[model samples]
Target: MAVEGGMKCVKYVLFCFNFISLFCGLALIAVGVVVQVSMHKTFRIMDVNASAGPIILIVVGLLTFFVAFFGCCGAWKENHCMVATFSFFLSLVVIAEIVAVVLGYIYRDKVKTMIDNNLSDMITNYKVGSAELRETLDKLQETWKCCGAQNSSDWKDYGSDGQSVPDSCCLEVKPGCGNGTMTDTAKVHQRGCSDVMSIFLKRDAQWVIIAAIVVAVLQLLGIVFACLLMRAIRGGYEVM
Candidate 1:
């Protein structure tokens, strides 16, 4: 049994969408790996709490990749069983993402606390940490234009070269630029990294939410189309 006319078009569109989803899954996996590796290389190798986000991304991506492939195969072959299975699995995936978003919103404060504590630990260990850690800290400070975990004053007794703030925190970003500049707001950034990250997330979070919504909508459409195709197949209507 197969579908005719519009059902045929729906079949091809579903296939195309699943093809696109496969690439999206690969992209998510790549991004997750990058984030996880970055976490490992910085902030004293993030604890399990900090590692959960990336691991979830990786798991979701892997599941998406396989399920989308299943969807594509079912659509192309017009197989009732495969199409039904794809629809069920895709629904589960969409539900899981929605749950993740809701949980993230509810636990946002805890996330902020974890980031703050990790950054503070890094600052506390900077004086005795390895060269790689120091370099990573310098890169972070330079990139964010932030002074310390909570502000420049947080470095009252700590620095790289017997100074109050590291040279990376200086406006000029040159050696000795931070010397005698802890009190000079013009010379060093007064804002803390934690605050900077918070500001950044507050400003950019809407974009992430928007993207998630769009993805969820697209997946829902795919699930709906797959179910329709399954129904047509079961009813012995030609969809090819």
Candidate 2:
């Protein structure tokens, strides 16, 4: 009887976890879509290629949402088969994430090699040699002063590794060759934590709304599942 009751409790807990996961997955999907759309707009001024991460994020988000839907259905029904099925899907999602991380590691050296090649090209091609590069850099420093006065520290740091500076920042320089022209542009292309934070802040209100909905849904679903599973377990144990 105790074992039966414990199994019932475990089921309830799993249901609750699934419920929360469902809501979180949906929220992530929504946020991913927003981020992708925003990236499109930002890419026009920045680099369209810069959006690769968001695009992948959007796909992953959608998949998560789908998986969450299955989980929610499973929990609602208290169907062990359905819940187990959903768990299988979740496992796949975990595997995919692990694979992504591994691929990133595997390709890291290759990425670095490409960046080195680009930097070497910059040093060799120097259309105007290092002297002109130095003068251009000085001009950038002067511009930084102006930006600083305007309370924009954006100009103070030079982009590293394949990162593109906005045209506005490097407008004075030859096209395709300014602060972003450095070999480090490749490195800069990856979105930083700050970039992710900016995206979140930009959609703060939307997230708040979505979060509220998710929380409410999860809570309601969790309670319903917990009570139902508890009753089912008690009955099963009594029969034992």
Candidate 3:
């Protein structure tokens, strides 16, 4: 009777955990969609290719969605095979999340430098680029209230006459804000795009890491419950 009661307890606990996993999977999918849409609007506008980070979230979410079914069914029916399958998939997900966390940390440290280099190149070639590129840079400068990649000086050679900053860098909108024999520091943003973008990237990366940690914790819990239920089911069979 003790063994039967233990098995019943384990079964319900596993069911409850798996139920939570189902919603977690859906949440991940939603997060991925939001990230993708935001990246598409900003990065895509700058002609920067979107990273695989968001896609990874969606893939992991889909995998979790399917694996959760095995866990739910196994616990409810006391099926050893189903429970074992759940354990295997859950372990894989845990491993993947760990790898992602490590990579995320490494990337976070390098993001600022990478953005600096990319923005520098973009600023140097701003005038020779497509209209879309020009418009994107203009909008970025205005929205961030920033100037060139590293400062207004980075645009020393980018003006139409090769002596001023872009009009978008102006502290206030006006005609010929970018026209002069020399850059007019008094009329333009003083900050750099590199610094502004670096702060934004760091914040976004932190959130990604937090989300991964949460998912990893939940997966670990699911694995534990699945194992406990498996043992209880095996013991009950042996007693019969």
TM-scores, one per candidate: 0.85, 0.45, 0.84
Where does candidate 2 have its weakest 10-residue lDDT segment? Answer: 145-154
Error of 3 at 29 (Å): 1.2
Best candidate, TM-score? 1
Rank by TM-score (best first): 1, 3, 2
Give lDDT tens digits, candidate 2, residues 7-83: 55656575567656656667676776787775443332223364675676667667766766666666556555555
* Cα lDDT listed for each candidate: 0.81, 0.47, 0.78
- In candidate 1, residue 5 scores what lDDT? 81
- What are the runs in model 3 whose C-alpha is more than 4 Å off? 1-5, 44-50, 160-163, 171-175, 180-187, 237-240
- Which 10 successive residues of model 3 have the least lDDT summed? 41-50
| TM-score (C-alpha) between model 3 and the true structure | 0.84
* Candidate of highest lDDT: 1
When superposed on Cα atoms, how far off is each prediction in RMSD?
A: 2.8, 12.1, 3.2
Candidate 1 vs candidate 3: the TM-score winner is: 1
Total clashing pairs for each candidate: 6, 9, 0
- Of the two candidates 2 and 3, the one with more favorable TM-score, higher being better, is 3
For model 1, state the Cα shift of residue 45 in Å.
8.0
Ranking by lDDT: 1, 3, 2
